[model samples]
Target: MVPLLVPLLLAATPPAPATPAPPRLDDAVPDTFSGVERVVAVGDVHGDVDALKEVLRLAGLLDDKGHWSGGKAHLVQTGDIPDRGEKTREAFELLMRLEGEAQAAGGRVHALLGNHEVMNMLGDLRYVSPGELASFADQATGPETSGSPRGFDGHRAAYGPTGRYGQWLRRHPAVVRIDDTLFVHGGVSPEVPAKTLAELNRWVRQDLFPGNPPGGAANPQGPLWFRGYALGEEQGAGLALDEVLKRFGAKRMVMGHTTDRDGKVRTRFGGKAVFIDTGLSTGYGRHLAALELRGGKVTALYREGRVELVTPVPPPLPIAPKQTVPRGQVSP
Candidate 1:
């Protein structure tokens, strides 16, 4: 009876989570950047083009005319830019244009993949708005066709693998490491198989296409859907969170899937993880904010003022050398 009870208890207990090693680096991969002086990250547009614009301006990344003005600084949009609101098309167009402009200006734009993007690719139109569908109508169809939303075919084509937006989005990454910080649409979890950044990106790209069979990498526990850092207790998940960051050689992780109720950028686990999804779309909360990382410090930028989240500790001053008196020189 005692032996049988021990076996049952072992079966009921869950296996310990797997810890991942640091990912291999590839010079050809664009998912990582270092030595960047400044990085501004925003989250979850939900097709609110105006809200997107407001946050860009707030971060000083965009000009009044919507041109890229961040100079050499990098701008990271942690995904969920489509659905809910009506201006997804315009939002994509703006991002596409800014990508080239920022590159020309010696800067970069990293638009990561969110769960919503994969949903759209998988034909999950649950959150897509009617106005969003109408926004894709061909110009030649005129106003009458636009009112009736005759662009379902066009909308489908545009999001198809061969379409403009689809092709562009497929080439974008799911996670990026800039300096010592990691950015992704959702938080990374330790429950899944250990994977390098390149492997993660390749898997996401493969699953986005129509013909490929799903490998379950896009499941709820994957990088694009995990909400542990945002909703889970640090005392329970803090050790696992440290392992996730270590796997990527990152000091911290910044994500934007789960929206905070107060619409402010919040940190967990002594600022090891940050949540930037302020629900910028009017549908969720109309609040606006962006995360700014510069000069070894982290700040949350809002319309009202900036709040410092992490500040660099100054290095200790070198000790002064003591002088030895010569044997003959003595007392004076």
Candidate 2:
């Protein structure tokens, strides 16, 4: 009987490991999307709604009435929609409205989280202007006194976890992959190269909630605050950049934390890194610059109909080779 049992156990196959379920589209952190004919990315509105609208119009994204006109083009706003200006509330409202409109038109509005957004969510109001605070007064009931606990308390309440904007903002990703390009508020740091996009986003989202430690989402070197790509040494930084791109399987990374020294949309690392924050906010005199990706080409679109081709960076060597997928096809 023992010999027979031994034979039966040896013949039985071991159970296969359970496969982890793919993230649901609604709850995915770094939302992976494909099949976009064009991509328009704007950086750091900083509460400057006028400049945002003008830039969108220049890119043929928004209509005269500020409606979604870019039929199937993807619109990516690289965070910092709040702070340093007075129209933060209005800026949020406009993006919120356009999000629905864009989707209905077969497009998408990917608004990645920036440091200022994280600050606001965590109760840091140093940059919250009086006008911005008053904008939400009517929506929330609170004392009207200035500098009091109740002052701007209404705004805070409206932007808290239970608030409309807060709920919407929570759903936004810290990093997103559209086609083969990566979009993030700040540059990715060395510590982040090992994590997958989904893991990176999941950690960030978890850190955003209250009572969490001050590392993942709030650290200076985190995705929302890291500037290594923008200010690092060429050779070393290029190596780090290669690792990040390889990890995410993206050809290029588009970011908006650091403004270009020349106040124009520019690329570094031979075009592996594109900086779109031309300081378009009124605080920066409304630079009115944006980055457009279409037909496998990158272009810098400026106010007054100025268009220039952005030079492409030579593909990094000895890492994962860049993969180019045809339109309407998803890359493996």
Candidate 3:
């Protein structure tokens, strides 16, 4: 019986896998950039993927197959990708794909946060079209009527804080500086409390997420809604615009949100600001347009042709009076 006794064997438990570190917030929402030689600024897709494609192709950014063809050219989309049209999902998906492709090709794609985007995130669906909602009908988890597509719930979920599209939108900055120009969905307003570009960017990004009590970006004069540069007179808003430019060290600002009456890209404040929103979406007459900046020259790209914008030479900065040292006195 003693010889039959055997020692018990035990198995060792494996260690748990380590949890991955969370991504840095700043890395996702950068405020400034430089040394970009070529840039294409397009405004307000508004769920019109076809019009967006045409503008991108005209800008030499998209190939015939709708893929990113710009080797090193940066593309700045001034938001409003959702609402007002049927193909909102399609438009957002295209931009999302192009963003990665452009980056891999040594270029960049910037999709700024517009008032509409913030509105959707905050449950404001006034401008959201029924067709746009139907695009997400298949993902709806709520009850569906006999003849109606149950997309309201799905759309809300998609734009929720933890949703994929919501996460992507949250990563974008409200304003970004590339080279000497600033690109924003809405023009910068001097009324905002934030002074520097960095502070403004932070302010908007903070107001975009859940449980933030949303301000600034949603304010009438905030970066996402301000029309001072686009609508205010040069005498009143021009001086404020200059101060904003000086504070940010940017020579000019490019923006969307206020569509041009003639559906053309127009510059304001003596070429200190460019408005690129030409109502490219179907709901706005499907105008195809984009702004091209290359080699320090601004060109407007249209479905018909291109036009160069001549900017005036900026006045020199004021120099302080020379401090002279007294005779026989040493200057420190």
Candidate 4:
């Protein structure tokens, strides 16, 4: 019996090493291009699908069934398509679907990343609605030890490196140049002016991925958060705004982080900077509007089919300091 005994330990096998995940795709495409005749830019959707659809319809970008109908025109949504509403998934899915449909139709859909998009990707779900969480439940899965499926976690995963939407979002540029105009979710700051559009987008991609400190893309003053051009003090801010425009070589910068009090897209810095947030989300009362650029002209398009020309005002200059004199002494 002892001679016939076998060593059970010898039959054991070591587990196979895991295959490493594939490298993140460089989805960031060219940030600058030309030859697009018409560009329709919308702002800060914030999960209000109805408002988004209405504005797109007014801009002639969407059909009644929520399909792309813009022909060869380009549609750019300047970020913030999540948070503050329950229909976040609906809005995201529509944009995701439109990207392909528009491209097939010889048009393009640019869904730039907003601050909220960055926040959700990085696990900040403070403003995420419960309904939004429930919407993604079927697609969410977690460890058996973890009780219910995490909806926000699922939503986050859907935009993660392996997620479909995440990959699509990654492929987009934070700053897109259509003809002579620059469209971004927020204003570009002075720090990164020297960077080419490609370089800026690369920095953003790195910031968005894990293991790097989020900078140019997610910082408070980065392209996704800067408000100086929209809400800065009138004097020096205008000069800064001009410098930003000069750096990008753009005739004007169109952005959507700061909503105007009247919920109307407004121009500042002598029309060099246009703020178009216009509270398009139900959280902001659904101010449906879009900025249309065509034939070297810019017009504000509202849901009611009214259009207003956007005229740039003169950029403000620094106030010259008055010559001072010693007390009781007059200047020569």
Candidate 5:
């Protein structure tokens, strides 16, 4: 995979200005990002542009005009851009647009890869952005002799190879690190070290993210897709501490993926990882939520929604069974 970082572009604000296309509690609009604040890290935004907007607004990232409200701080987006939520394409666009504006503002937008990006990267096609499904269907039908956007066979060849939409998604980053906290759409893979942010990134690249095989075995899954716990049988605290020991460095892991109710990342991993998923879409109708991290403290950032915790989950998932390292075999 290409290791190119974002271009140096955050010198000035993106004066191009985006006029929001009417709010519909549905899809995302260009101007929905208006007036953002300094540094804000969002959870799995599974295509809830409305919820995302609300959180951004609450975080003081958007202005009344609905532009990039974040002043000098950056925006952290944990992945899972496609699947489940309806407006995933818009969600991806939102990330890209935010990154672009961050560039112009001398600020940065950090987007970490979730399993969705990986699914999209390999052209799995099982999960797709609802917005572009029709377009993808059209591509799969081979060529249309009549309204070929360009012309006949020549026009078909002109269209970008490997399907434009899926092709576009491959450009996203698989992981992002903030201070000691490793930001991933999924949880940490057991095979990968949670010691340092750099070590984690290298593990993703070598064992999990791209390259496919770590010394010939299948690539490990990214954090978000890792639905189960990574440590032993203890409940929340055990997982938390394990995550802290592995990921949060000396601090705690502030992440989104597992369902969090009060915007608190609860775990049995020894206070190592704190989940922030907050089930933003909620599927039922309760609203979404986000966690605000600044200065060395943290707080809940919500879009004015409340979570009615009917029942707290008993025990978290069990720690993954140890994979036997084959004798005479080396991992990448």
Candidate 6:
């Protein structure tokens, strides 16, 4: 009674109501930049600097310096921003710059996170030797063979290092949800909700990246790189479109991890999961592939010539020399 005597004359003013939690990413971010009519979704952009430049050139976004030249078109990169190529740094920088430039030009560059990005963060994939990560990496690419700034691979000396860009990409979003279409580098796990994607990003950014991985299965390693099933590969896990849709709150989905039959962008999942990885790196001398999403439909595939397909040959797993731990001697 004595402890509360001082407040007897005043009704306790309720502490200011806790501020409502900020809106979830989907609620806060516009699926589409307001007023943009169409969005261009590009496939895996491994360290193909020349190919990146060409793609941007085709979209009218880059000139000679790999700068933003697209005045009004949205550019959606379907992940694969690192590894398997040399100019990963240049490509990452150009894309980051274009993100702002595109927005300023009444357009936008949506940098969707892909599996390779995750691998790079975990030190799984290597863009170049540790010492050469900065200088020897590839720059922005478009198609076919790529070129360097001073016009030679030796110009790598002038390009500096990959540390600048590699670090920035580690925190990038693994997937970008544009309007009703989920722009992802890899396929959406059969039934992840849009909130789950946001949750994963928040967890990684806030927990996983700072020497604090929240959990293995629920961590960035799982969602960003998991492709346990194919679109119609009855042999393994089948894509559950209904569940995938429920997770993203979208009617359709567009992903670019696996490839299609003709090695060009093809629609699959009966309009549910669209496979856009046409293996552009294979150098089959075919048309570069892409997709145009409009009104919740894939609308069109942008390639039209015989192109190459990077038929992935899954690498053999490393085997211990002789099961060093000895059968059941392994620690429990």
Using lDDT, give the best candidate's number.
3
Worst 10 residues of 5 by lDDT: 23-32
lDDT of 3 by residue, 84-136 (tens): 88888888899999999999999999999999999988889898877788777
Better of 3 and 6 by TM-score: 3
**CA lDDT for candidate 1:** 0.84
What C-alpha lDDT does candidate 2 achieve relative to the native structure? 0.81
TM-score of 6: 0.63
Model 5, range 99-151, lDDT digits (tens) per residue? 77767876677766666555544444455444434333334435555653322
Error of 5 at 35 (Å): 22
Compared with the true structure, what per-residue lDDT tens digits does model 4 show for residues 1-332? 66444555445656679864533535537678799999999999887998888889989888988899999999989999988888887898899899899999998999998888888777778888888866766555563225643575677667676675666677777888888899999888877734588877777777767787556766677889888888889878888877777877888899998887588889887678888899998789888888988877789988566565654556899998998888999788
Once fitted onto the true fold, the runs of candidate 1 whose alpha carbons sit more than 4 angstroms away are 1-29, 139-149, 315-332
Cα lDDT tens digits, model 2, 1-332, are 88889878977978789854422323755479887889999999988888888888888889999899988889999999988788888889889999999999999888888999988878898987777766667656555666564337677766677676777788888889888899999988768633688778766766666665554568788889989888899999999999889888898899999987466887778788988888898787678888888867888887656565664557877878688999999988
Off by over 4 Å in 5: 1-38, 127-132, 135-172, 193-199, 202-222, 228-232, 235-250, 261-271, 282-286, 304-332
The TM-score obtained by model 4 is 0.82
Among all windows of 10 consecutive residues in model 6, the one with the lowest summed lDDT is 151-160
Residue 95 in model 4: shift from native, Å? Answer: 1.1
Stretches off by above 4 angstroms in model 3 are 1-28, 141-149, 311-332
Best by TM-score: 3
Question: What's the ranking of the predictions by TM-score, best on top?
Answer: 3, 4, 1, 2, 6, 5
Q: Which residue pairs clash within candidate 1?
A: none
4 versus 6: better lDDT goes to: 4
